[model samples]
Target: MARLLLLGAGHAHMTVMAHLPEIISRGHTVTAVGPLSRHYYSGMGPGMLGGTYTPEDISFPVQQMIESRGGEFILDKAVRVDAKSKKVLLQSGREIEYDVCSFNTGSSVPQSIVNANATDVYSVKPIENLLAGRKRIQSLADRGKISIGVVGGGPAALEVAGNAAACAREAGCKNVSVRLYAGKVFLRHLSPRVRSLCASAMRKHAIQIIEGSYASGVATKKVTLEDGREFDEDVIFIAMGVRPSALIAESGLPVGNDGGLAVNRFLQCDEHPDIFGGGDCIWFKDQPLDKVGVYAVRQNPVLYHNLIARMEGGELQPFDPGGEYLLIFNTGGGTGVLHKAGISFGGRLAFFIKDYIDRKFMREFQP
Candidate 1:
């Protein structure tokens, strides 16, 4: 029986977990590793921060799901992969030998720009960090006025800024203020119409959108701009986007310019066909994809099929990223900005659509 190793309890691996019984019945052993037993759906993370959803609402019991399906689960972080030895090294000094391996390790927010010792400085990643920041912000706002700073020009920054304001307001803080430090023009990569709608929504929420300069440094309750300006705040969120985990590159595997595991159209590493990956952790050689969950969700079935195919010497299937995906941003205050196929709009209806889709996605994956 061949051994299969799955890394990270991310979107693409969810399908593998669901079909673990079938894989085991086919004479293969499955083992999954992740830092956390529960996998939180990032799409609903902002809602959790804004008190629209609880931690339980957006998380999946990954460990339980794996064990129930007759698969082994390891609650440890993978530090490196010895591709030549066909082994994966864990932080705890454990080595797992696998005939086939796949990565869905996700990504992390770059924290180098922020002071490591700074307090109340949060990164818009790990999803759980937002919950802690929410509690801290609410506790501080319970006393008096507070100013929050959000650094980044992407959708993640907008979501955090708006939801943080909503969180403070829900705590009955009447003097809560939010400022978004959008480097250069906000949403520079998006359509002008989407940018206008987003800006309007920010203004409606009394959020100050600061552009022209990027945040050069982030410290406790203070942010220094590249243009030599400074702003003091009660809390700061560093949403400077995300980067793939360094494990793949550190393991001496082939990677793309973004440091993601480089994979071919079949989602297999060209140099090592037995090694496969998807999600934000992989760079598809055919085309560069946005680091969004939609692509990972699409790669699910293909990864599942190919992993089994490799073991059985069957033909592998090529992954098609598909057509335009619907993009929705829950910008707090019970509103959202949605864009799909050149159609863009904003308001409560958009939020409802996003909410319905997110909840449905959770239901489908949650065991």
Candidate 2:
């Protein structure tokens, strides 16, 4: 039986879990390694902060789901991958041998930036970090003085800033304030209309928008901008871009300029066919994909099929992202904006659509 080892219980891996029964029936053993037993769906993060969903509502109990699907679930972090040796090194000092391996470990903010503002910087990747940051802001707001500084101009930063403002208001803090440091061009990827709507929502929520400069560094009491301006911020959240785990580059794998593992259309590592990766960790050679859940979610089915095909000595399927996907930005208080193909719209209806889609997606992984 071929041994198939999965690194990280990310969204794509969850799809693999859904197909585990068939893979096991075909005579292959499956094992998943990750530090957490539950994987939080990042789509609901804004709602989570807005008090619309709890952690449990957006997370999948991966161990339970994997075990129920007849797969081994290891609660350990994968530190290294010896592709030539077909082995994966875990944090617990165990080396697991495998015939084939796939990575969906996701990405994180650069350590340099984290360290530059370690005193107040909180990342949004782990979900827990954002939650803790939310609680800290709440506590400070309750005490009567709070200022939130968010870095990055992408969806994550916008969602975080908007909902965080709403969270503070819901906590009854009249002294709360939020400021967004949108480097140079804010939401450059989104349509102009969507950008305008987002700006309006931020305005409505009382969040300040500062464009034309990026954050240079963060101090305990304020954040410094590249343009030599400083804002007094009690807390700073770094939602800037994320890069793949250092293990990929450290393992001698071919990577993209952005530090993500380089993969072909088949989703296999270019230099190592037996090794595969998808989701945020992979940089597709044909088309550069944004590090967004929309792309990751689309890769799920393709990764599922290709992994099974590799183990069964069958043909692998190719992945094509096609075109830009729709995006929904929740601005809290039963309001949201939808962006697709350069067109944008929003209202109470948009929020309901977003809530329905997110809830349905989360329900699929429930035991």
- Go through the candidates in order and give each one's C-alpha lDDT: 0.93, 0.84
User: Which ranges of candidate 2 are over 4 A from the true structure?
Assistant: 114-117
For each candidate, give its TM-score against the true structure.
0.99, 0.96
C-alpha RMSD of each candidate structure in angstroms = 0.7, 1.5
10 residues in a row with least lDDT, candidate 2: 109-118
RMSD of 1: 0.7
Q: What TM-score would candidate 2 get against the native? A: 0.96
* Candidate 2 C-alpha lDDT tens digits along 1-367: 8999999988877788888898899899999998898898888887788777888998999999889999999999988899988998898999899998999989887545444535756777787677787787777777776888888888888888988887787788888789988999888887789999988888888889899988887667677888899888888888887888878998888999888899999999878889999888888898888888878788889998998888888999999887867788888767888977766887778789899998998887677
